[model samples]
Target chain A: MAKVYNFSAGPAVLPHEVLAQAQSEMLDWHGSGMSVMEMSHRGKEFMEIIHDAEHDLRELMHVPAGYKVLFLQGGASMQFSMVPLNLLGDKQSVDIVNTGHWSKLAVKEARRYCHVNVVASSEDRNFAYVPAEDTWQRDPNAAYLHYTSNETIGGLQFPFVPADQGVPLVCDMSSDFLSREVDVSKFGLIYAGAQKNIGPSGLVVLLVREDLLGRARADLPTMLNYQTHAAADSMYNTPATYPIYIAGLVFKWLKQLGGVKGMESRNAEKAGLLYHAIEASEGFYHTHIDAPFRSRMNVVFRLKDDALEESFLMEARKNGLIQLKGHRVVGGMRASIYNAMPIEGVKALANFMQDFARQHG
Target chain B: MAKVYNFSAGPAVLPHEVLAQAQSEMLDWHGSGMSVMEMSHRGKEFMEIIHDAEHDLRELMHVPAGYKVLFLQGGASMQFSMVPLNLLGDKQSVDIVNTGHWSKLAVKEARRYCHVNVVASSEDRNFAYVPAEDTWQRDPNAAYLHYTSNETIGGLQFPFVPADQGVPLVCDMSSDFLSREVDVSKFGLIYAGAQKNIGPSGLVVLLVREDLLGRARADLPTMLNYQTHAAADSMYNTPATYPIYIAGLVFKWLKQLGGVKGMESRNAEKAGLLYHAIEASEGFYHTHIDAPFRSRMNVVFRLKDDALEESFLMEARKNGLIQLKGHRVVGGMRASIYNAMPIEGVKALANFMQDFARQHG
Candidate 1:
């Protein structure tokens, strides 16, 4: 079978090694006579899988003490509400930096539970760049300041971690989690849907400071309350067991390649290869986003002629490179080269872009 | 490796054929050069998988027109809150029948949003039987009448569908969904976690009457509201893709086995084999649940002497039967013979139980 380079935004490509291991263990995981999907969440075998996954992830991210890592479900969308439900304790509002699509979603969801103060916004410029730190209007008594470290749809990323003031910081790291190294202690909470950097689409990883655990609103549903999940170790109900097992395999894969730092280096090299091609293309291809804030994870760009874009996507698919189409909201192409995307795939994509540009220009 | 029968509840055994099929397709699904896990939810390929799953499920359950089937996350536990949040619109209270563990959980969660009037409860009898229908005190003006069709922990099932009587019937069919045929038109809403009769954990299927779609309270979070999912076709955000794919395979498997009627016959035969063994054992082995109310899915029982139960479990495991230990709340043994557990496995379990009783007695 011809190999293909998959670049679908989230629910994107996974490390081949992890899929191979999972395939081998599909019927009888570790000689347990049952697939991981068949094992009970409370069983010792499955428990070990979840425990090791958390440990490896914590080690990879250098997560500090007194922080709880929760493998949750409902994707990052659920957390937009859960964050406010669990953390808004007596606080009437929270601070938000609205960068693009994801941050807007967080803002809309948070507004259901609390007053979402727009501390800073890049929407005035169609969210092509992050607003400067100095532009943010601080909310001293807000519950927390929330932002997207990387906006996948708009192809913008925060170049610098916002300075941690005395107030806690919350982040949605769905697209770029573990793609680079970050100080875990800088944020009070970090959540990532597992489809991108982790493993699959069913599970989400949540890292929350211990102090944030029991402060959920009393009237919140048991499952919606963070403390119920934190206290029960994220198994208050049956978790996404099979997905957790696959993610554990991914964590092991990351560790074998030397953890998050190793991933960051490889990711940087891949992103550089593709971005260099875009830069070399001159006026044939264009990335309108500010250079510093152009996302390393999602490279969004437009071709010189709108008529040529469809042909470009069609040809790319024919050549076994898939999902290069951009978000529908933005009429351009987006190449999401996540952690599992190898340098060779990015090089092939860059070569294709160069060839396509020469023919179309 | 010794082949073993898996009996642990939720995230229990799936068909071996399903596991094999998933193994073969893990890396390159139907020559797409992408695992189902790696596909975007909006892509045609993954969309087909989700659509086929919902279609097969609808066909099997004989879901009527003007009903929407939603594939969701957070399991049935999340539905506890969602049910109230959605159905409690313009209503102050709802009637519930508390049969056991799962029903009580629903009651506790619903109370947070509405006055949950528990019209009937078997709690006084330790949930060993369904309270007689004639004795129920259901509220006439209740927004909806809710009940657990099958309680996994107590091994209790409602022998008869509760009378609708102009009130919308909402059922949590998590443990027994698709195990038997049901007239879907009778209930306004039904939800099942994809771990028992369905496939894997982390995914839930909700079938709601079309008219019931948009009544969710305005304050509900976007993800928590069922209407949000219905509007987006369950892709308001990235869904549990892998689990949904697996569940689709399960739907195909069910179709091959001749749908729910086929499952019912096989399940009845298997359950009969095991339940007959318990009844035939006289005083040695005992099932405290009323005969009519005993669950076809989870068969809960105990040995006369508590000391002998450990040895029975140990020898059973040595003989290749696993996960037979009962829940902590009711300490003995529970053999959850879901749709996937073949009759041979039930025969093996029954034979082990009879032989152990003969030897120990």
Candidate 2:
């Protein structure tokens, strides 16, 4: 089969080497005579796999000692509910920065449990830029401040983490989790869905501070409680075992590639290549995002001539670049070059974009 | 490496052919040039995959019309909360049958939401047998009746489905699902955690009647609401995509083997062979489970001389059979032979047991 580059937002592309290794170990993992999928979660083999995954992740991200890393299920959407359920101990409200689609979703779910304060929003400018920190309305008595570091569908990202405001800072870093280096001690909690920068869907990697544990209401479901998972080392029930195993392999891959620092350099270079192609096209291609807030993960753009959009996508697909269609809400083209999207794949898309523009310019 | 049979209670063995096909398509699926893991959940490729999975599941189980099949996460433990949260629309109490470890766990979670009436219990016999239906204490105003169909740890199963009591029947069939044919219309909801008899961990397959939708409290988290998933066909959130794909393959394998009827016969024969060996050992091996209530999925037994138990397990591992160790609470041996366990594996275990008894009796 011809090689094809997948630019899916997520359930997205993974490192080819990781997939190859998984295929090789599909029947028996480390001579255990049992596939990772078939082994008991309590068994020594799976225990070692999960432990090593957490250790590698902590090492790569410089996770602080006071935080507990939980490999949970139900994706980031589940976190929308859990954040409020666990964080709203005696507080009556939560401050949320609504940047775009995903941030608004967090606000929506949080509203179900507490008074949600939209501290600041970029909706006035169609969410193409981040709100300035000085212009924000602060909630003095809020339980915590929550924000999404990256808006996947809107192709926007926060230029900087919010300053701590006495309350805890919680971030939904689902799309840009391991793509760059960050000071882990700056935030109280951070979470990412594994499909984008890590491994597979059905697993969410959560890092919550120890102080935030044991605050959930007694009525909260056991599975929804972070304390339950933290106490049991995330083995409160049968976890998504195979997904965790795959995520472990991805962590190892990242470590070999110089951890998050190496990934950041490669990701910046890949994003630079595509953005450069769009900008160099002059009026032929355009992007609505502000330069400072543009995501290094999802690069969204459109052709100057609206009629050429379909032809651009169809021709790109023919050239082996697929899933470049932008989100339905923002119709155009989006090349989501996540961490696993190689530099060569990004270069191919950039070249394809430039050629398509020349033909229709 | 030589072949070995795994008898894990959950996160148990899967069909070899399914694993082989998954391995073969690890890098690229069919001609799509994208592994199923890399495909977008909303993309046409994954849309077809999820749709076919639902179709195959319905056909194999003879699922009644108006039943919404939801491929969800969070496992059966999640359902313990969802059951009462969604079903207790106007009622304040729910009737529950306490059969064993799994059932008691469900009861523990349900107590956080509503008044739980323990209608019947098998705890008197250490959960060795299912309580007689006639002895149940009826809750006339109960919203529904919930029970565990098979206890994986206690090695007990209900001899008959409880008769309808003017309310819905919600069953936790996590261990016994797809091992036999059942009348789907007898229950309003059925859920299985997919690891035991179907695919992998992290994905929970839920079947709920249409009438049960739209009953969850407005304050309930959207992710926990059945109406939210049913209205969107279980794509309300990014589901466990790869697990669903593997489960789809298992459904196909089940169909090729003549569906649940064929699997039921095979399970019975396998259980019979192991149970017969234990009974004919003349007190060398003992099982406390009543004959009528013995589970066909998990066959639990203890050596008459408890000190030799360690030797028994060590010798079994030497013979290429593994994971026969029982649950920690039950200090004995349990061989979980779900639908994927070939009869040959069961025969091997039976022969091993006889030889061990002859050498040590």
Candidate 3:
């Protein structure tokens, strides 16, 4: 089969080795005579898979003792509601830093449960950059401070984690999870959909500080309550078993390549190469995101001539690049170079960009 | 590899052919150069996969035009909460037929949102039988009548759908989903976690009558709201894409085996073979469930000697029949013979039971 570099944001590309291993084990996982999909979630075999996944993730992230890692379902969108339902407790409001698309959605969902205090917003500049942290208003009484670490759609990312407010810090890290190193102790909760730089869709890996567990509203749906999942080890109901298995395989892959630190360096190189190509295009290609806040995972840019954008994508596909079309809302091209994206794929895309621009310019 | 017959209750056995197809397509789906797991949910390729899956499922189940088929996450446990949250519009109560474990859990979740009027319960008999329909104490003012069509743990199934009680009917068909033919017009909603008779864990297939839409409580979490999924065709958020693809393959496999009607015949034959083995064992084996209510999907039985149960499971595994252990709540063995568990597997288990009893009885 012909191979291509897939750049779709979330439900995006996976490590080829992981897929190959999964393919080989599809019918009988480790001679258990059942596919991982067919194994009972409560069974010993699957328990090992999930346990290994969580253990490896903790080691990779240096997660502290008081943290609980939960493999859940319903994606980041589900977490939007869960964050407020679990963390709001008796608090009257939440503090939010609106970087872009994802943060806005988080704010919208949190508003249903509590007053959402907009501590800072970069929307005034069309979300092209992160707001200066010092200029942000602090809500000392807010239950927690929340932000999207990376906006997949707008190609914006926070270059620095906001300093801990007096309240707990929560983040929607769906796009950049595991792409870089972070201090796990800083966040009250961190959740990311598995589709990006992890495994497949339908699984969300959540890390919540233990002290924050029992604060969920009593009337919250049991499945939506963090305490329920935390208490049950994310098995209150059946988990996304196959996705978890895939994620475990990915963790192994990541570990072999030197964990988060290794990934951070590789991702930096890949993003730097692509950005250099774009800037060197000398206006043939342009990116709105400020350099300080530009997302290393999703590189969004537009062609100089609006009419040439379609041709750019078409030619990119011909050169074994696909799904490079940008979000419809963003109206350009977006090349998402998540951790799983090999540097070779990014190099090929960069070369193609220069060649396309040279011809079209 | 030593092939064993897997009898896991949920996340149970799958058709070998389906696993093979998925294995072959793991690297690149339909020459798209991306695994189905890696494809963007909104892309044409994945869209077609979901569309065909819904269409084929509708055709197989004979789902009426008035129903919307939703491929969702969070399992049937989530449905326990969603049902009451979505269906309890202006009504203050709902009727429930509590047969066993799953039924009791459904009632628990429903109680949080509405008064759960238990119309009938066989818990008096250790949940071994379905209660008589005429003795039901259904509330006339109930918003909907709900029931667990098959209790996976207790090995009890409703032989007949309850007669209408002047309200909409909702059923958790998780364990027996697609194992038998049913008139979709009879129920307001039917939901089943895919792990049993469909695909993998984490995906729940929900069939809701279109009229039941738009009745969710305004305060409900958007992900829990059926209207959000229905309006987006189950793509309100990133779906469990890989699981849905597997389910789609399973639908195709079921169709090849002649859809639900054919599955009904095959399942009945498989269950009949195992039940006959138990009955003919002459007190060597016992089953608590009444014959009429015995689940064709989960065949629960016990060895006459309690001490021999462990040995039975160990020996069964040696003979390549695995996961025969019953739920922890119900001691003994439960050989879940879902649609994918071949007749040969049942025959092997039957023969093994007879051999086991001959030596230990």
Candidate 4:
């Protein structure tokens, strides 16, 4: 196989070992004489796959008891609606902190179900930074306080969790989940779409507190009710079977790599390499998100000269660096170095950046 | 690899060739150097996968140009709620046909959004037969009339499409979709969970008439909103990437096998072999569903002596057949012979049944 570095903001890079293992077992998983895809979701074999996956996920994240981990569908966007539908049953209001594109979507969707209070927003400055907590407009009786821990689009991240003051804290951690250590107990719910840092596109991870279960507005469909999912263990309905399977493999891979603490150091190294190169380029390359709030998972930057951006990307692709384009909303170039991206890949990116600056700067 | 015939209801058997092709190209689809799982859903490579898959599906199903095909997540069960949420909107009433487990779930979910009118029901006979249109209690002004073309659990199928009399026809074709051809123009909507007959689990196919576009409740999430998905070409949110890709491969395989006409014959032959064996067992085995409403994909039956069922299943598994157990709601055995099951496999199954019955009976 040809060597290549994938920089797409997931569905992004995955470990080669996992892919090879999947390929080898594509026709027959564990000598069952049947592929995993062919196993019935309710069958004992697939039940083991689900059990191991959930077990590994718990081990990797150190998910505490009393917290329900739901493997749902439709990415984080679906949670934007499901969260409010299930959590805001009687409480008609929620407080939201606007960090970037994702949380903005959360606020918009929540408005359809409840009174949405924009607690803090940096939209006036084109979302170049995470808002200071002091500027927040928190509600004493709000059902939940929602925010994005990491913004994939703007590549901005909240430096620390905000004090909820007795209110339930809900987060859309789509892009940065499992990249570092997190206090699982401080929040009512944390949902992450698997594409970015988990495994694949279809499986979404939802970590919800036990106290928040079963109180859905009667109008909420059973599928959308977190309590219903919790009661049946995310298999209340037929789940995204294969996606969950792949995610299970990813969880195993995470365990082999020594869990989230081990990943935190590796991710920091990768992020630091790319960031150091950008800084060393002497203003040749510029970052958009403000320094303290910048994301470690998705390194986004722009060239001083817009004319060179196209050439840079083209050259990078020629050299086997692919999908380095930033999102349309946050333009320039984005190198999403998630958990699976090796430190060597980041070194290659850093070296490439240095050479490109030496030639064009 | 030990030879095994897996009889899973879904996430069920797949063509070995399709699985092999997927395994070989998994890490680098057509030299893209990225696993289909790793590619951005919006990128060129994935767009090609979606484009080819859609074109192939459209050709196979003979879908009309005025209809939109949306690749969605959350299984057919989610559609139970989404359909009503989209179609009924503020409407107070809708019509439903309860044929079996699938339709029962559909009706239960629809009851959350609308006053569901039981247009027809087979519950009087344990859902072993579909109630005829003449016996239905459909309303003159109901929003839509919904039915499941085939209930896998009950082994029941509707022999005739009910006249909607200007009302829209919505069918849950999960178990029978694309296994046979139908007049797409006559229906307002068709949805199928891909696990049964289309591809793997996670991805679902939704074919909706254009007239119903943009008519969803305003509060529907972007992913669940047919209008949002239709407008963005099903890439509104990162879809079930890997499952959709595998499904594309299955669609290609179907086309190569001469489409639905070819599949319909093969399905008939397989079902015939199994059903014929059950009937020829001299009342030693008994079929639950009536012959007129018998399913072509799944054969449900029980031994004359209920106590002998477990030993029969255990003997069958040791001899190569597995997962012949029926749904818990209906005890016995169910052999799901989908499009991919070879005639030879059915013959083997039939021969084994005769030998086992001869010795045991």
The TM-scores of all predictions, comma-separated, are 0.99, 0.99, 0.99, 0.98
Over the stretch B1-361, how does candidate 1's per-residue lDDT look in tens digits?
6899999887899999999999999999999999999999999999999899988988888888999999999999999999989998788999999999899999988998989999999998889899898899988889999999999999998888988988899999999999998999999999999999888899999999988878888878888888898888899999998988999999999999999999999988998998899999998888999999999999999999999888988999999999999999888899999999988999999999889988988
Pairs that clash in candidate 2: none
Identify the runs in model 2 with alpha carbons over 4 angstroms from their true place.
none
lDDT of 2 by residue, B94-130 (tens): 9999999999998998899899999999898898888
Give the DockQ (C-alpha) for candidate 2: 0.86
lDDT of 4 by residue, A132-229 (tens): 88878899989999999988888888889999799999988888898899988899999999998888898899999999987788877677889888
Q: Per-residue error at A314 for model 3, in Å?
A: 0.7
lDDT of 4 by residue, B198-272 (tens): 888888899999988777877676667899899989988899988888888999999989899989888888888
User: For model 3, which pairs clash?
Assistant: none
lDDT scores of the candidates, listed in order: 0.91, 0.93, 0.93, 0.88
Residue B27 CA displacement from its true place in model 3, Å: 0.5
Residue-by-residue lDDT tens digits, candidate 3, B185-289: 999999999999999998999999999999999989999999999999999999999999999999999999999999999999999999999999998998999
Alpha-carbon RMSD, candidate 4: 1.3
How many pairs in model 1 have backbone atoms within 3 A of each other, for residues 3 or more apart or on separate chains, i.e. clashes?
A: 0
How many clashes would you count in candidate 3?
A: 0
